[model samples]
Target: MDDLIVKVVVRLAGVYENHGERVYLDAGHRALLGIARAVQDEAERRAGVGGNKVEGPVIKFPLDRAWREKKDRDDA
Candidate 1:
């Protein structure tokens, strides 16, 4: 992607996720997919060698559709 295009994508993604989504404005699925790809690329670049590899048991992102279905679900 072009440098300016990447910058625009990142900025738009940020605004949509942070503010636009909260206001009931729909961020189309295709844009979301693009954002994901862009972010992953940025991460891999910043992480350097083996950055894309996940070797730990840690969960970076939840796979469940409704991890918050129950409020106060966690134990203290």
Candidate 2:
């Protein structure tokens, strides 16, 4: 997979023309764009920010050893 990605990137290397010039994207870039679009659409469909989401300043804490210990203590 790494080799394939490298090969595609190498193929994409070139001196691009100035703006307004009709240029075609490499096969790799086209495929990547398609895949990205598909993934984005799927994510949008599955990820619903409906009435379940609460509006607020959300704070995220790292799950470290100390946090785990506190959680265990609280559970007990």
Candidate 3:
């Protein structure tokens, strides 16, 4: 499950770069969050866990912040 998440993230990052975009907007962040949540939820459900409980900090918060910072620095 973790591997799947990593793969998805890497693929998305590649797509973003290939598209000539230095930063992602809310839509991109939401897409990432949706993918992660879906994968995690499915894994939990398969394990007999009821309800989607994402353990750990929200991935988008840090990711979006870091990307924005990088974009700002690059623009400057």
Best by TM-score: 3
Judge candidate 2 against the unseen true structure and give its global Cα lDDT, from 0 to 1: 0.58
Model 3, C-alpha of 15: deviation from truth (Å): 15
lDDT minimum window of 10 residues, candidate 2: 15-24
- TM-score, candidate number 1: 0.29
The residue-by-residue lDDT of candidate 2 on 1-76, one tens digit each, is 9998786555555313332223325444665876686566557657863332434644344489988999999999
Candidates sorted by TM-score, best first: 3, 2, 1
Each model's lDDT comes to: 0.63, 0.58, 0.72
Model 3 lDDT per residue over 1-76, tens place: 9998797678767767776464545446877778787788778878989664657764445458788899999999
In model 1, the Cα lDDT at residue 46 comes to 75
Tell me each candidate's RMSD, in Å, in order.
Answer: 9.4, 14.5, 11.9
lDDT of 3: 0.72
Shift in Å, residue 17, candidate 3: 17
